[model samples]
Target: MSGSPYAPHTASETTAMLDAIGVDSEEALFDIPESVRFDGEFGIDAKSEQAARRAVASTLADNDDLTEFLGRGHYDHYVPSVVDHLADRSEFITSYTQYQPEVAQGFLQALFEYQSMLVELTGLEVANCSMYDAATALGEAATLAERLRSISGTRVLVPDLLHEGRRGVLDNYVAGSDLTVETYPTADGNVDREALTEQVDETTAMVYAENPTVRGTIEEGLDTVGDLADEHDALFTLGTDIVALALLEEPASVGADVVVGDGSALGLGSAYGFGLGLFACRGDRELLRQVPGRLVGASEDSDDRRAYTLTLQTREQHIRRERATSNICSNQAWVALRTAMHVASLGPDGLVELANDSVRRARETAGRLDELTGVQAPVHDRHHFREFVARVDQPAEAIAADLEAEGYAVHAVGDHEIQVCVTEANEQALDGFVAAVSEVVR
Candidate 1:
């Protein structure tokens, strides 16, 4: 009686199927505990939409207003107002998958442009329209390495300092495969060339490294890492945000076979949990066929005018079916659009200036903090981008909590190492933050 009326099965048919499966009832098939099982009950009184909104707003208002210098992966950049104005147009925001090429030209073209920007930035030939976030994008890259016929190995090598979220996701992505994720050491917050060389051999399938690594040290020996991967016939994958790509070494030049990381760093500011994954790879035909998510391509229409359409869809929903490269059914098209819009607003010079500012701000802020009696700024002896780790005389956790009490937030990355990120958005509070840190440490 509780079954769907449109289920197409009569009571007798359902009973027969249940009997065939040796289950007395549908509930028997699910092992849900009785205590945790849902029961029809009016647990709370309903409220008007306005009343509900007011309650939520009041709850959110109770959150402390702390100036955040936290950036382990999530970052805050000032998004221009024009990005919001253009991206909010219902036509762009509400548009779903661009399946029908004829009516979806506008969104398809936007995605094409987004792909083009990534292609230009990464120096990789093909860039997908989007991915869920850096975690999933990294997961997809590991699997892509597994799928490539040219790369034959069971090991996926990642830096020892790789963020846990990315490592966890990569672990799950290859859970069903024969690939094993292993860690290589980092020297001075960068790739430990000798250690990495020892780890990557004929048994290695892929080598993954991040520029401006999680510890905020700008990598110095990427060329050697690339050459190492090449020597082993392993696919080299580089992870970085779009903003850093403008000023950092080009991924392709470093022999990166696949490029993946956060692309929303430009348009969306500080989505603590959410992200837009950037995925691109070399134009090798073998590599192109295995790229995940969607790739919007450009071409000429019947009228001889340029046109855009979904060039390659390797997700499960597409023609690939059971043999699909990935199960990524949806993409972050809207986020990609926003990023493209923000990048366009900045232009090349503006982007370069922002990238340069990141380096300068981090260096200057570190210098200011280093001046403190108990603080030794820049735990790593390498150039940093937008952030750096500082060694404090006090426990990093206590220092972080004290800073929060002082209305500032920073990451307690180690026992005495606290990571502070400075961006244009938080630059105004640097003096206050430094003063607070100076006070807190003593």
Candidate 2:
């Protein structure tokens, strides 16, 4: 046997396996080009499991413990202990997509509740269990719009201030198709209605705008945008922050045909890379049929007892490739479960209060930072939710770097603009955050 404890087989066994594969040597089995293959021994020396764990832990401990104020697409939010406690259960954490409804009733129910919650929040008729993230959800929304025969257009119009990541993903999603992505101008930190009206034409399939824009300015005139979309016979896709939705007006109220956003703000505290995409649409049958991801529905079993099951699975795995609404094969069930638990725990009143508190902190912090001579309170003169842009005298990067050195993390959105995000979790850190900005500016 190999001396390494991690090795799964003896040397003799490996040689026998190679022989069975008709390869004389292990190196010969690999198809890697000889010119690029490594000739030297690996630098990592094998260590005991415990020693390896300790080494990794020690190295991770060296990372700076920075207080976060960053938010462009991601935010640092407080996750209630109950949310983690319930979501971390082995059953929920390890479970994959609930393929078998009988054994997956609990997960299906949770996801159904998640869909219901999103429907309520967005004022849409139906919602899917989950998507990869907000960016991907937006891409799916565009693709779904393109599929609708009534909305016969080959272009998707996006706000100029849309997050670059989301725009990039949209570009990639439509790259292989006949769709063309274009940007509408923004004025005073909101989508310029005149420009949008001028740009949207018979060639436009969908028009998307973020409520709380990437620059952290609350978008105004959503109803007007919707009207413009109607004039062009284009779908109005509204992208928003779920937490802010607790306090902001429903997209459907403003005539949104589709809603797409991140659900992570509820309780999925920043894992940086992980997020849950929230998607919902109007009650139209055609719209529901085109929505991506999986949908959980409550129904009566053969015994006439109440039960939950996967109702409409439109992804490639469930349906034929030619008819699948989306190629996405997986859903964010665990993250959606966490979101459901968190939203249920907060209830309606608590969610509204949490959103209000976040806005309060953003405004208070902006006011305090504005007191500094070199900084403007908010880059835009509109109400903001969890984040705001602070126009500083120094280069935004330098200010952000200095703040980082002092153990705080903030986003530099422009040459002289720093986007600061404040959530309920950062309530106690607000003053310290403002003080850090003051010091950095000085």
Best by lDDT: 1
Poorest stretch of ten by lDDT in candidate 2: 311-320
Error of 2 at 66 (Å): 0.6
Please give each candidate's TM-score: 0.89, 0.89
Error (Å) of candidate 1 at residue 251 is 0.5
* Candidate 2 lDDT tens digits, 1-442: 2267967887799989998999898778789997998889877887888999999999989988988887887876788899999999998888877778788888988888888888899998888756788899999889988889889998999988888889999999888778999998999888999988899999999999998888777877799999888888899999987888888878988889888888887768888758888888986888767777788888888899999988766545556587788887767888888888999999999999988987788788889899998999788998988889999999999999999998899898899999988876666887788788888897
List model 1 lDDT by residue over 1-442, tens digit each. Answer: 3544347998899899999999999889989889989888776556666887899899989989999998877789999999999999998888788888888899998888888888899999999856888888999999989998998998999998999999999999999898999999988899998988888999899999999799888998698999999999899999998889999999999989888888888899987668798899998889878877787888788998988878766544568887888887777889999999999999999999999999999999999999998999999999999899999999999999999999999999999999999999999998899999999999
Q: Each candidate: what lDDT?
A: 0.90, 0.85
TM-score of 2: 0.89
Candidate 2 residue pairs in backbone clash = none
Which ranges in model 2 have alpha carbons more than 4 Å from their true place? Answer: 1-49
